[model samples]
Target: MPKKYLFYISQNYSFAILRPLQAEIQRRGGDVKWYLEPNVNASYLATDEEQLTTVEAVQVFNPFAVFVPGNVVPSFIPGIKVTVFHGFDAGKLDWKGKNTHFRVRGCFDLHCSYGKDMTKQFDALAETYKTFKVVDTGWPALDPLFTTDTALNPYISNKDNRPTVLFCSTFSPRFSCAPHIFDAIKKLSESGKWRWLVQFHPKMGADIVNKYKQLESENLTFIETDNVIPLLKSADVMLCDTSSVLLMFLLQRKPVVTFKGNQQGEHLINVSSPEQIESALIDALKQPDELMQHIDDYIKYIHAYTDGNSSARVLDAVDNFTFDSLKTKPLNLLRQLKLRKKLGYWKLS
Candidate 1:
């Protein structure tokens, strides 16, 4: 019998993160199916992709392993739960001043870490939890970034050969640079000195989204898409705030200009004022030696795999996992109840 795998997704972005792994699983003669929560749009599932809509359907499928990009998964489900995280640690803090990225929700059996820094942190967490194991398999989401041809990106339209600047921001009002930098971007786009592409987080405010959409012209284009990889490939430089998407752009060995980033990193050209945006973009496009060196160093620390084989590594880790010897995960009764209620699954099994 072929190995059966389940992909439990909660958001549209999960598709990009898990598709590479799906390809790898199918390549190995495995059957893969997706289970999208109510909050996630079912329309995002491609015609060729398979989906299990209800918890009952998922139980019937009897997958050998379940992969989740989010923090939590239904422990009652019949599978070895594995977590392939959604994004990089952009140093965003929670209400209690805790790093949100490393939080242990007691749901996963294995954490497929991105690189050395993440592996070290997860290793410590595993030692403390004693329920889950850490494996540094890099990130499958970035596999296409290294392997795909950027020339085919549909968004790239620099007919005049002008520098392309991609602007992206977080949705949170507290951390977003969108509101602050809009005027400056408007002026720059009007100047026609550089080509501009604006793509915002899906959860960004409608008012703000409309405001940027109005800036579309010969020099500027506002894009709305589930996948940002193509946009990342097309841009010469990226303009961002505290969003983790900047890390994805930096992995391409490119420079980024961030607006008052929450994380202090030498790898980014962080500007405190809107007035500084243009100069920073110019400097970033130049790609100075020191900035490029810092980017390289940070990439090595976060994700050193540029060979586009992270999906294979993730499968290998899953295959080698000692499921029989694993300890019991935390009960997490309240969380379990919440998940059950959300999925409308009443059975104890």
Candidate 2:
């Protein structure tokens, strides 16, 4: 008999995208599981949130197989555990260090990204563990954004009747210069050329939050919600920093402008100057067809899945895992424990 598995999904942008797929999986008589945070109320289905420890989580679910996207809590479980990383956020502080994702994965997903730099990171990860399969599934999160009934996304109907530019940036001191990414957008705002949808990350500091709150621009509207893809579509241009939103905008093949900072690390990718920002924004505002062509050539290495059928392909790869297929070695266990200790997630009791 095919194994009845526990599909463990966690909190993040991807869960909203994959929630609808549960019915698709359930029709085949497979059980799916998820963890819901305190804030979200999933009235229709049940999810387990007790994600404090790995062994505890495994014991709680207690299914034939375990499934989870790349989350901090899923690192401790034993047996056939599949991990799917949407991007490189866990180790963004020191991205150059060895990719920790190889330690425990029937699969690790890095397919959400579409930048040239992101492809290089995955290539390095591929060199680390030949055991973990890295698959490019166009972000499963984008799937829902594209498919959800228009009623699910009411922003379009309620949108202000001005052409809008979404300015999205990640929250990090490193990306401090990113707030200025909208300087050009403000120029457009002044001329009543377009409206601006300014979004703040969940991690933004109070100081940064207050700055936006005090802003006197009527042309700008602030957005704080999980589903931002509709806003992405409604915008004429997207001004972004190093956040994954840039990748999503790229999927739209829209023009994205980064900052011209000094140090080019993970969060802050240094561009040339304001001229480049204006140039990129102008290109995005003008030639979307040309930008789509750039996305075709740019996505070759970064995100492998172009079509919206990523979830179907991923399940196919998971189906290939025969019972008792992947063997466990003693050294592998020790390496995992040692790595966890370094990450401070283990007590070794």
Most lDDT-accurate candidate: 1
Candidate 1 collision pairs = none
Cα lDDT tens digits, model 2, 255-288, are: 5656643223332223666556655566556755
User: Relative to the unseen true structure, what is the C-alpha lDDT of residue 187 in candidate 1, on a scale of 0 to 100?
Assistant: 99
Candidate 2 local lDDT, residue 235? 72
Q: For model 1, what is the alpha-carbon lDDT of residue 246? A: 96
Per-model TM values vs. the true structure = 0.98, 0.69
lDDT of 1 at 93: 96
lDDT agreement of model 2 with the native = 0.53
